[model samples]
Target: MELSFQTVLSQVMLGLNNGVFYAILSLGLAVIFGLLNIVNFVHGALYMLGAYVALLGYTMLGPLLGKPDFHLNYWVALIVAPLVVGLLGIGVERTMLRRLRKFDHLYGLLLTFGLALIIQGVFTNYFNVSGDAYDGKPESLEGAVNLGFMLFPKYRLWVIGISLLVCFATWFVIERTKLGSYLRAGTENPELVKAFGVNVPLMITLTYGYGAALAAFAGVLAAPIYSVSPVMGSEMIITVFAVVVIGGMGSIMGSIITGLLLGMVEGFTKVVYAPASSTVIFLIMVVVLLVKPTGLFGKES
Candidate 1:
């Protein structure tokens, strides 16, 4: 099969779209683990919930509300789904995570892992399809836009733009603001931060909620592109963990850049050698671990 420059550009674009999701999801994981010192194994499950929220809102909201003709639209679900999932995250932090702070960090990991399994099991029982169709792409974003080199889906372009915006905004808030300094301080010494009148517990809870919200936001963005299935989260999480590791665990900027670059690498590999596309990132991971176990941008703790 002969490939053109346009074909190559298209794959890069497709990979960029995928990279955007990875960047956002891994960003959430980085924030939670970097700040809270908790290994949030349920991050992927929350991402799954985000997609399901969008799916059910469009398909069943009207019926569930007894207004058969009315339905939740794409724009509303984009906002509502994250809010709903973030609230659930807040609930989890308050009720379950708060109690285990003094215990070993492994407890948090185990608890979240158990919660993830339970959530996946429940959804698996209800959605037993290869994937649930979600026709929620807004009409404005339905067609393809002509780039100078190639035509790209307008919805995908929107996703790349918006996801990038959100990721940068998050990085800015955490890396450059006064509130971020407080969060960092709280993370290092909560009692000291509390002594200065900051409600560290509330801050931690909100941070976790925000991280979960980021995952959900990615889910909403992804619904139109990927199949909404019970196993989607489980499938995506490992790759995301790789992204997080490669970028350096808890790195704010590393996750963003590494994910985009690795996705492009994966895309380009498909062009150069199809079989290596899937393992290229892992191969990179292996090399990075040997070279700098702390990760590319990861600092030694």
Candidate 2:
């Protein structure tokens, strides 16, 4: 197929959309893995749950509190869904993850896997697995802006910009803040951090909650771009896993940058070679592994 500029630009937009999720989800996964050493297989489910919660909010409260237009209060859902999921994370950490601290890493992985299955199943049972388009879109972000060469959706631009901001904020907090120093210390040696009068267990619990919250936040952002469904996260989660592996678990900045870059690459592939887009990320992962076994930014375990 002959490549056209418009085709490439369209692909880039699609890729940026994918990149938003990858960047956010991978960052959350990296944070949890780095600090708590938990794989958090339930992250995808948590993301789906965020969307569901927003829907629930719309169903119950939007009518009573909505503006004159039928906007359905998505902005409120975007804020509240994550908080609800964060609370759930706290409960999971306290009840399940804390108990597995002394077990093998595989145990944590299996446990989280089971949790994912459970959450997904429950959601599928309640909400049709076939998927439903989000009922609401924020009017504040409606319409498209004319770029020099193309018209870009305002929401799409918001996704890309907000994702970048979130990623950078996460990196800054983890890499440059005093709290981050303690977090790193806890990750390296929880016992020592505890000895230093820190509440290590509490910190670990909060970290997981924060990670889960991040995933849920991504879900809220994603509801408008994609349908809200139980299965929405299933495939994307697998792709993000590959992204995390390629970026390296030890480097938050690596995950952020790699996610966006890969998203753009995937989009370009879709434009030029549609058949190869799905596999392009895996191909990149293979190349990275061959060149750097530990991953692009991952530290040696």
Candidate 3:
């Protein structure tokens, strides 16, 4: 079969769309690891919860609010889900993660892993393995635009644009701003930052919340494209982790660039050989590991 230019272009665009989610999720992971120095295994579960919250808000909450005619739309989910999940993240960090901070890192990992399993289990029991569909899209973003080369969905373009914007905003805040400077300084020497009058503990909690919020934001964005399911995060978290590994944890810009690039590579792989699409990113990860164990942008310890 002769491959058409439009087909390839569309696939590339789709890949880029997927990459936005990867970038956001990995960026969250990078932020959390950079500041908190703990691997958050429950991030994917939080991502799943965000989608479920948006789903519930759209289908159940809207009707309960006496507005069945105008159901909760994507915009509402965009705002509410992150706040809800971020608050949940704060609770988790303060109540559980804080106590484990004095112990080995494995304790934190195990605790989060258990939390992920618990979250997934509860949702699975109620929602079952089959996915629930969220059909709400803002009316303003209902159509596709013909870009001469390809007809792209406006919502997708919005997603890509917004994701990039958020990613850059996050980068700028962490790398160039005063608050960001404090965060960087805290990560290196928490005692010193604390001695200088910074509330290091509170900052750590908020950083975790912010990371969770990022995951939730990505979930809300993804709800329109994928079904909201208990296992959705589990399926994607491993890939996002690989993206972090290939990009290097704690490197914000590295996470963003590697994610988008890998997404493009995966999309191109699908165009050339459909079966290898799933493993392409992992293959790249392996090669990167062999060549540079610290990752493309990671600094040597």
Candidate 4:
């Protein structure tokens, strides 16, 4: 089979789209790992929660607010979904995962894993579809744009660009700002930071909230591409975790870059070797682990 330039371009776009989600999800993982040192197995559940929240918002507003548009403003969902999910994260931090910090990382993982099951089960119980129905496409951004060779879906392009912005902005805040310094310092010496008058526990709470917010934001973006569903987060979280491992868990920039690069690689693999596409990320992770163990931009602790 011959591949045209347009075909290659389209495949590249597809890969980038996947990468965008990978980057965002992995970025959240990185943040939680950075401050709290937890693996956050419930992140996927939080992402699913975001989508469900948006779906609920659209539905509730239709009759109550006299708006039956069937689509929440993408920009509005972007803001509201994260805030709602972030608040939930704060609650989780206070109630469920707070005391576990002094325990083994496995405890956090198992706790989150159980939480994931509960969240998914509740959604499945109420929704009856195991996932939210596709809310349908946003009308405002439905067309395609002409690239050099291929016409790219406008929203896919938006996903790539907007996710990149969020990723880098997050990295910049963590790496270059005073808030970041306080965060890193608190992580390194929580007692000292606390003595210095920083509320270390509150910081921890916010950090997890921020990570959940990031996942939710990604979910809102995803609702436009894939249908919202309870299992959506569970489905993609494994691959994203592999992505985090391959990028080195602690590095924000590494996660973003690796996400985009791996996405492109997966896209090309799909076009060139469709059979390998499913397990491609994991296969790469295995090789990376054997070679460096720390990952592409990983450093030893």
Candidate 5:
């Protein structure tokens, strides 16, 4: 099959859209790992929860509110799902994760893995494994743009733009702002930060909440594009973990850049050789590990 410039451009755009989700999801993982020192295995499940929450919200709102035609829209789900998931993250942190903090890090990983399984299982039991559809797109974002070389979906372009904005805003907060300074300091020396009268525990809790919110936000953005299902995150999270590893867990900007690059690589691979698309990122990861174990942006321990 001969591919034209337009075909390549469109594929690249599609890849960028996938990259936006990867960036957002990996960014959340990096944030949670940076401060909490936990691998957050449940991140994928939390992400899945976010999508389900949006679906449930949209499906239930009308019936519960006694208005048959009045369903919760994507716009509302975009805001509400993250908040709901973030709060659930906070509850998990306060009740479960906090107790295991003093133990080996593996404990936390194990606990979160168990939690992930439980969450996925519950949703699978209720919804069945096939998955649910979220068909609505906001009216304002419902069209396509003729970019001369390619016709691009307006919603996808919006996703790319907004995702970049959110990712950068998050980077700025953690790297430039005063609150970010506090978070960084706490990560380095929690005892000292506490001695300085900072509520390090509360900050940690909030940080986890914030990270979960980021995942949930990604989920909302993804609902229209992907099937809303229990295993959605389970499948994507592995790729995301590779993104985090390649980008390094400690660098927020690294996650964003690596994700976008890998997404494009995967997209390009699809054009060149269709079957290699899924495994390309993992191959890159193996190369990175063999060459620089610290990752592209990670610091040596």
Candidate 6:
């Protein structure tokens, strides 16, 4: 089958749309794992929570409170959902994760995995299992913008821009700044950093919250692109885990580049063989693990 350049570009753009989410989600995973040393299996459920929070904040919240005329707007939902979810993350870190600090990594993973299941179950019982359309797109981003090759939705462009900015800013914060130095120092030697009067436990709590916030941020972005569904995160998380693995756990730049690159690869595969796109990332993950168990950018501990 001969495909035109426009068709190829279109798939590439679609791939990129998917890629941006991968990049953002994986970035969060990397952040949590890098600093906290916890495998956050609940990241996906938190992402779903972000979307539900956005939808309900704008739709059900005002009415439920007998203030039907006062509802959260898209812009407000964008900020509120992440904040609320991040605060919830803070709670989890403080109340649950802190208790497991001295335990094996498997314990943390199991805890988070159970949390994800419980969250997903609760939502699935109450909400539509298939999906719910989110009509939360702001009026300002209602139309498509011409991208020379094609007209793309303004909301998608916004997602692309915002996700990139957040990812890069995070990378810079952790890699370039003085505070980052402290974080790294605390990661390396928390007791020593604590001796310097740095609140190491507080820092760890904040880091986990930040990572959860990142996942929620991605969820809000995705709310418009795809229907809000409980299973949405479960579906995406597996692929994202693959992305994280291929990029190397705890590797920031590696996750970003690998997410984008693999997205493009998945897109190209769709054009070549529709059936293979779904499994291409996993295939790459297998190969990468076979060659370097540590991952592409993951360091040997």
- Per-residue lDDT tens digits of candidate 5, residues 151-170? 89998888899899999999
The list of candidate 5 runs beyond 4 A from truth reads: none
| Per-residue lDDT of model 3, residues 126-210, tens digit only | 9957798888877788799998888899999999999999999999999999999999999889999999999999999999999
Q: Estimate each model's TM-score.
A: 0.96, 0.94, 0.96, 0.94, 0.97, 0.97
Q: After TM-score superposition, what is the CA distance of residue 119 in candidate 5 from its true location, in Å? A: 1.0
Task: lDDT for model 5, please.
Answer: 0.90
Which run of 10 residues does model 3 get worst, by summed lDDT?
A: 67-76
Q: How far is candidate 4 from the true structure (C-alpha RMSD, Å)?
A: 1.9
Candidate 6, 186-262: lDDT as tens digits:
87788999999999899999999998988888888888889999999899889999999888876688899888888
Where model 6 places Cα greater than 4 Å from the true spot, the runs are none
Residue pairs with backbone overlap in model 6:
none
- Listed per model in order, the count of residue pairs whose N, CA or C atoms clash below 3 Å is 0, 0, 0, 3, 0, 0
Error of 5 at 162 (Å): 1.2
- Displacement of residue 256 (Cα, Å) in model 2 is 0.5
Clashing pairs for predicted structure model 1, backbone only:
none
User: In model 2, what lDDT does residue 129 have?
Assistant: 78
Report clash pairs, candidate 3.
Answer: none
- CA lDDT of each candidate? 0.88, 0.86, 0.90, 0.88, 0.90, 0.89
After superposition, candidate 3 runs with Cα above 4 Å error = 63-70
